[model samples]
Target chain A: MNPSARQPVRATTSINGMIITVASGKGGTGKTMVAASLALSLAAAYPQQPPLYLDCDVEAPNAHLFLHPTLAEQQEVGLLIPAVDEAKCTHCGKCAEICQYHAIAVLGKKTLVFPQLCHGCGSCTALCPEGAITEVLDRMGIVERGSAAAGIAFARGVLDVGEPMAVPVIRQLKKWALPRPGQVVIRDAPPGTSCPVVETIRGSDYLLLVTEPTPFGLHDLRLAAQVAKELNIPTGVIVNRENGTYPEIDAFCEADHLPILLRIPFERAIAEGVARGKTLVDIHPEYGDRFRQMFLQIYETISHS
Target chain B: MKILLTATSPSIDSNVDPRYGRGAYFIVVDPDTMEWQAHPNPGIGASGGAGSLAAQFASNQQASSVVSGDFGPNAYNALQAAGIAMYLFGSSATVKEAIENFKAGLLESVGAPTGPGHHQH
Candidate 1:
């Protein structure tokens, strides 16, 4: 059954439970696919109490293609940037000096503002000795809330094109979708070990790190592992295409004492399904049970730890 | 009119700093009197936006024109908007020579920024 055809999912009826964030050290490691499938399976098992699926990868959010949520509400996200009051101005050049992004430039009496380059840190406004600067809201992106089948409450952030910052939208998304007690929250964090990934996974109870058994994968996986360690978040590995003799990633996991939660073998059909925007679980219902079992393991680990 | 020239040394004999935003020092001089002061370029170590900061410095110093080897896009726009003419001074040109060139109308006027921003780092 198509998820959108179902009734609205009750996202916050439960208690203070774990927020599971699914992240990868590198891109294209099936991060979104796994997160989506896991959310779908959890929703299926808990029909009355659905999980919350948050696509925190604002730059390139694609989980909605598989979830097919019917977005019932949409809201715009913005950042507070500086706008100058020119009439009362002395050409102090202080605003330009204070702005690290150099968003403000004072050429004699001419003040040029580069809105695109502004990080909206308010440094210019705060340090403006003449008080010529005031804070203004600039649209960053949009956040949409919807419900998919199996009672999953879905929320995703779509960043504005050419926007470098992703944390604000992610912050707003998390604030909008507060986790309920005993209810599962699965976040599809952006790839890489950058600030965006760190921001998304910071407060999560458990981090499901996805990787492949290869040299590049293992290298980035180590970096991701280190981030989880630094954040003090308990983490496990889910190696994609695990049917391989590549012992590097396995050895690293063994050495690191990280649990291998679940593995999907090297299957062309799964890739083909993903290419068509159909998740592996959608193509092969059996994988749904596999993801559910993995969730159980994660839950046990979270509970015990 | 006061003119700003990027310099590596405090004196006019110093070679022109080829960089605009990241220049080590900015020398503001009156071409006729040759009166000048060299101030440290605060934008040199800036993570980004050095160009704009440098341009703003030129305006605050009351410079009608600026001479630099290179200008980033941000610097070009700021200087241009301020109605300050920008001239290109090669590495071989000394600060004294650049001032003379500006007075002699021999310096090449730059309407556009020379290269991408942050290329120095």
Candidate 2:
């Protein structure tokens, strides 16, 4: 395989606007908490330059749960799929033969079109000599925008629960969530280093990978770190639930000379706050201070480099 | 067997036109004959990596292999499952060029076709 073809698109980190991603390898690692608090903390520290919070975890998007932004705008994200015209189609099995997605199948006199495999690319129709195929847009999901209580510009993408693709919805949300000049953007990415996570962090200037102090955390942290390193984005570790668990994160950072931005200790209040859909910065203001410190350290590092 | 091409497209005009679908086309080619066909994706139920419903459609076609401009993870996986091999084109060339490349044996196979019906929907 050609190396360049498989290579991921490089994200530009020189832009003054910062994109800090809150990502964890495993679920329930307080990734969302760290992401939300970072935004709130940044807003409080630089009230004039409040941060914009984007919840890219379309699978179980909960940034809205914490920020609870009033719905300002909502619209459906769509993907184009092919529909067969029986009148024009001879069921010559040509469409099925040409379909790379296997979305079109001709059986006897009838044919079935699978709506999910369609990438909306027009190769099939163009190849059809009979002109039996047409394209149609299908609503994939909804992207919502609003303002949070803290005046943080809020955006979240919710892929229809069954929809397999989150990138399209994320792409749409990102279009609206582009960092305005001088605005710090905090993105709470989906768990795991998958396509959705890649899409969430694609244009980020900096990534704040939030992992816990556990064996699983370490394992998933490695995966998350690999993703960050693959993207060549400058990243730091923010250890959440820093209780009596593995300290390997610190060792990993020290060994790699990676900066340990900040650590949020395990606390019941944080859990309760999350359960209540309340921002931890509001639930417990002290955590906000630590988050601000984390943000400042990241800034200083970026400035130095 | 005469080759057929399939893709997901939402517009009839676009299926025939080469400009839409981001220039991505699904080409099903008979490996032996190299004769092929094309279809544009309609973009429905096509989400979530390649879906199971899509595998069913491919199984129905008994497609030997699929060639396309791009494959989202879902579609990629779904196609693999249906006992169909997936080949990525060498460049953003036209469907005609892709066919030529495939016939000339210039393209590369990404992976063996995956198990069918892996997609839930």
Top lDDT hit: 1
- CAPRI quality of model 1: acceptable
Q: Candidate 1 on A215-283: residue-level lDDT in tens?
A: 888999999999999999989999998878788888899999899988888889888999999887787
**Which portions of model 2 miss their true places by more than 4 Å?**
A1-16, A92-94, B1-117
The lDDT for every candidate, in the order shown, is: 0.83, 0.68
The TM-scores of all predictions, comma-separated, are 0.82, 0.68
DockQ, per model, reads 0.47, 0.05
Q: For candidate 2 chain B, which ten residues in a row score worst on lDDT?
A: B11-20
**Can you write out model 2's per-residue Cα lDDT over A194-267, one digit (the tens) per residue?**
88898888877678877788888888888888888899888898887788567788888787666788777788
True contacts kept of each: 0.77, 0.05
DockQ score of candidate 1?
A: 0.47
Deviation from native of the Cα of residue B75 in model 1, angstroms: 3.1
Which docking category, incorrect, acceptable, medium or high, applies to candidate 2? incorrect
Supply candidate 2's per-residue lDDT for A64: 73
Q: List residue ranges in candidate 1 displaced over 4 A.
A: A1-16, A93-101, A121-131, A243-245, B1-19, B22-40, B67-73, B87-108, B112-121
Positional deviation of residue B70's Cα in model 2 after best superposition, in angstroms: 29
